[model samples]
Target: MRVLIVGAGSAGLTCAWRLAREPSTEVVLIDAGVDPGPDVPSFLLRDMVLPPPFYWDYAEFDRGYFLPRGKLFGGTSAVNATAAVRGHPWCYDAWGSPSWRWERCLPSFRAIEADMQFGAEPYHGHAGPVPITRCELGGFDHALGDAYVRRGLARIADHNAPGHLGFGPFPTNRIGDDRASTLRTLLPELRGRPNVTLRPQTEAVRVVMAHGEARGVLVRTAQGDEQLLEADRVVLSGGTFGSPEMLFASGIGPADGLRTAGLPVHVDAPEVGANLVDHPYVQMGIEVSDPAKPAAPPGKGALLTFELDGPGHLQAHAFAYRTRAVDPSADPCSAAVTCALLTPESRGRLELGTGRARVRLNHLSSDVDARRMAEIVARVADVVADLASEGALRLPADPWWHADDLPAACRREVVTYHHPVGTCRMGSDTASVVDEALRVRGVERLMVADASVMPSLPRGQTNLGAMMIGHRAAEFLLEAPPP
Candidate 1:
């Protein structure tokens, strides 16, 4: 059987790798951008950590804040900060399906990571392609992370351990001197394997549907030639924005929206480009005067987790280095802490623009979110006060920090964590675009295996979760009877 998988990102790579092992099944993986192969120079590795060539440049409706999505083989996992955080267990339980419970998802999670610090533990896997390393901080920075441990929070060296709630080193998907991108790890392992074709610079424009079944996809090849590729099954791993936009362009999605865009409606899936969610983030700058002889650390460390009302409600990620030039004369060292509301009540939407995907990230649109940010900021102020006493960290009494109207400040200061999910939500409900098995409703041999299918947001970074979705998709397809 021939299967076509569009988008060679985190999820797509994982799914394609699993299917390529079956000699009876032919797997074709396609992406829109160039891969640059495994010969990336070490000098340029740090620059590669930031989004550039593969990023899809998007912006908020009014704020014009940049929103980027990786558009290449490894996708965002290749460009992200290498954070490997698995959210609190309740994050999965909230999905309301046993198939997606934390217990069920943990095995896939284990199967994907080779945790350096916790490989022998029952929860972590030691043989996966992805190398998970624990971040360790030296010097004075260790004192700061330890302060939280003293505050009665559970001391957890392993962030994935049961009841992990305190501050320590962050687990990252980095292998020694390099980032563990799927192309560098998983894809390389599948190279030269039979029954697998990996093509870059090939864009999938739309899914070809016939009699309510997915037959194949129409594509624009690297040479700018348009072509049709047929397959017995098709999976859309194009991601949060790409998946929904592909659906909209393929004669699916809301009838009104499709008609207005001069496209014929097929399935009339209204939820195709709706229910967008992201963590609302706030970055606070800190300055340290040299004359004060403040203790400064060398390496970055720790993402402190907290519970405001319930599990994994909020998080604080802080860096020890300077972010901006505070004063030119003194050349004071500066640092920053990023705080975010994890379980946001706000919802956003994605629309197809003339040149790009238009996003209306209606951040802080809910009263519950406003209150949560307010409370989170207040708690931060208290923590900053204690840290500032030794002159190591200076939390300036900025207008936003001292403002009496905090709710209004929250509205203005909110930014995305870039963890968008739910564009093509999955569930058993009729309104959902896909079922519990991730098969698209009203379509045969079609599935969505990306962050877009998340019914609700996971209360942490989404790269690991997205990879697991790809693993699950492959299992479902393998277990099903062939068409």
Candidate 2:
């Protein structure tokens, strides 16, 4: 059987690695990017624990644009902070699909993890393809974790375990000094496999469909040439924006929207590019009197879900790290805390621009969402102030600390956690693009394996969810009768 996976990101690599192991399967993975170069962002972030390779120079884009995703072989995982959180169990249970609930998804999660640390914990899987390890906790992380425990938050030894709510640095997808991206973890294992062919710098143009069934994809090669690749099946892992745009270009979205693009409507799935959700963060940097200790590096520490409720629900997810800027004479004496609003009432959408190929994200599109974000900022300020009162947490005297400045702060400082989801949402509902099994509704030989298939964003990061989807896709394909 021949399978073609589109977009050589987390999901595509996962699928390729799994399928390559099957004697009867032949897999071709195509990505529209360069090779997995040595200086890739994931490698830099994991080794140096710095924030440059993944973080774009926001000054280059409009102030509204934040957290630009990488277009490398490992996808955003190559540039992300490597925080491998499994999310709250309630996130899956509330996804409104039987196959997506925590009980049904845990096996898949367990199947892919290779726990390097905290293996004794019940929630984490010890033996798997991807390794999860705990970093050394610094003084700031230790203090922050203790603060959460003092405030009644449960201290979960392993955040990936079931019902993860507490203070602790979650396990990261890092193997020693290297970032354990799908490309690094799974691809290397399948490098010389006869059945698998990895084609980087090949952008998938559109799904090739015949009589309502997906058969292959048209790809543009690095040499600026277009070619058609045939396969028994096509899986879209182009993420929230790429997948929907591809679907729209192939006339597989809402009739009216497709019409606006001067294209024929094939599937009429109106929700293809709608219902977008993201976790927005408000970062607070503090300068400490002690200049000898720089912030602990990434993967070292994090505190999950510091809940504060009033007129609206506000959850402050804090990451305490040491930085060197605090004291030039001392070692590195600065710590920064970033609080993200997880359960925002606000929502957004992924819309095609005037040009059909262009995509624009309308973030913070709802008044309720904007207001809810404001409330979250207020609550975060309260938490920061509370921490400062104890004298251990020293927040900078920046005017951004004032609650009255939240609107400006929201505009200037808010950024995404890189967890954009629900564009190609999965559900049993007729309007959903994919079913509970992740099969494209009304389409045969086509499936979506990415965070875009998530019906809702999980409480934590989206990497684990993407990995789980890839694992589930493998299971579904393997269990089926030979094509």
Candidate 3:
């Protein structure tokens, strides 16, 4: 059987890796970005954000702020900070589907990572393609961790340990100084496989539909030539933004919106680009008390995940890193404490546009989210203030956290965590875009296996979660009896 998978990011690559191993399967994987080849730049592996020509030119969502998504071979997994967190068990249990519960999803998580720190644990796999490690804490990270411990939060040795949370060295997928993205791990294994074809610089224009089923895909080559790639099965692993855009391009979205865009409707799946959710964050800049003290190297250093005492258990993440990590032009002595609302009530939507797709992230629109995010900022600021008293760092003269209208300040300064999901929501009901098995509703021979299908955002970084989804997608396809 021939299978066509769209997008070569974390999910697409993982799905391809597993599916190509089947003797009866022939896999064709297409990506819009250029291949990374054998060697990727060492700097890209260290930095959380990547340079231009590597990202799609999506329009800025807010004032002078644009979301960055990797458009290359390994997709975001190659470009993102190698954070390999699995989030809390409650995250998966909240998906409302038994198939995606933490108990059901642990195996895939284990199968995908070779955890250096916890390999001996039954929950972690030691022989997976990707290698996971934790960074040793720098001086500032050590100080900040101590502050959290002073506040009575347990010092967690392993954040990826199921349901465990506290301040600790951030989990990352890396080998020494280099990144362990799919390009560096799975791609090497897939490169010489006879049954797998990797097509880079190829864009999926639309999934060709006939008799209410996906017949194939019409793709445009980098040189402008367009052709049909026929296959027995088509999987949309194009990611949160790209996957829904593909659905809209294929006229599988809301019929009214498709007709308005001058496209014929294939399926009236209204939720194609709805239910957009992401972590909304605001930062508190810090200045080193002594300029002579060397700043921590750029990129993620340490993380603190905790839940406030509340009804919904307001989940939040506090990351301490050099300001230059996110902005090269920023001050070398400057640092930042970013507070993000992990479980937000506010929902956004993406709409098809004449040019690029319109992404409206109504972040912090919900009162609860705004209030809770403000509380997080205030709480973390207090901790930082304690450090400042000890001559660690200096806060802004007019701190945003000090504003009388704290929630208002949060709304004015909110930024994306760059982890968008739920655009092509998956569930057990007909209203969901994809079913529990990851198959698109109202269509046959078509499936979506990426972050787009997440019903809700996981409580942590999504790269690991997306890869797990890919691993499971291939499992679902292979274990099923032949059609």
Best by lDDT: 3
**Candidate 3: tens digits of C-alpha lDDT, residues 7-71:** 99999999999998886899999999988787777766666667798887775455546768888
Model 3 spans with C-alpha error above 4 angstroms: 47-49, 60-64, 291-300
> How would you encode candidate 2's per-residue C-alpha lDDT over 135-237 as one tens digit per residue?
7766656656666666677876677666556777668888776778876777677777888888988888889899989989999987889998998888898
lDDT of each: 0.78, 0.72, 0.87
What is the C-alpha local distance difference test score of candidate 3? 0.87
After superposition, candidate 2 runs with Cα above 4 Å error: 37-63, 120-122, 308-316, 322-335, 354-383, 386-394, 405-412, 481-483
Listed per model in order, the count of residue pairs whose N, CA or C atoms clash below 3 Å is: 1, 7, 0
**lDDT tens per residue, model 1, 256-288:** 988988888988898888999988887666665
Candidate 1's displacement at residue 108, Å, is 1.0
The better-scoring model by lDDT among 2 and 3 is: 3
| Candidate 1: C-alpha lDDT | 0.78
Residue pairs with colliding backbones in model 3 are: none
Query: Among all windows of ten consecutive residues in candidate 3, which has the lowest summed lDDT?
Result: 291-300
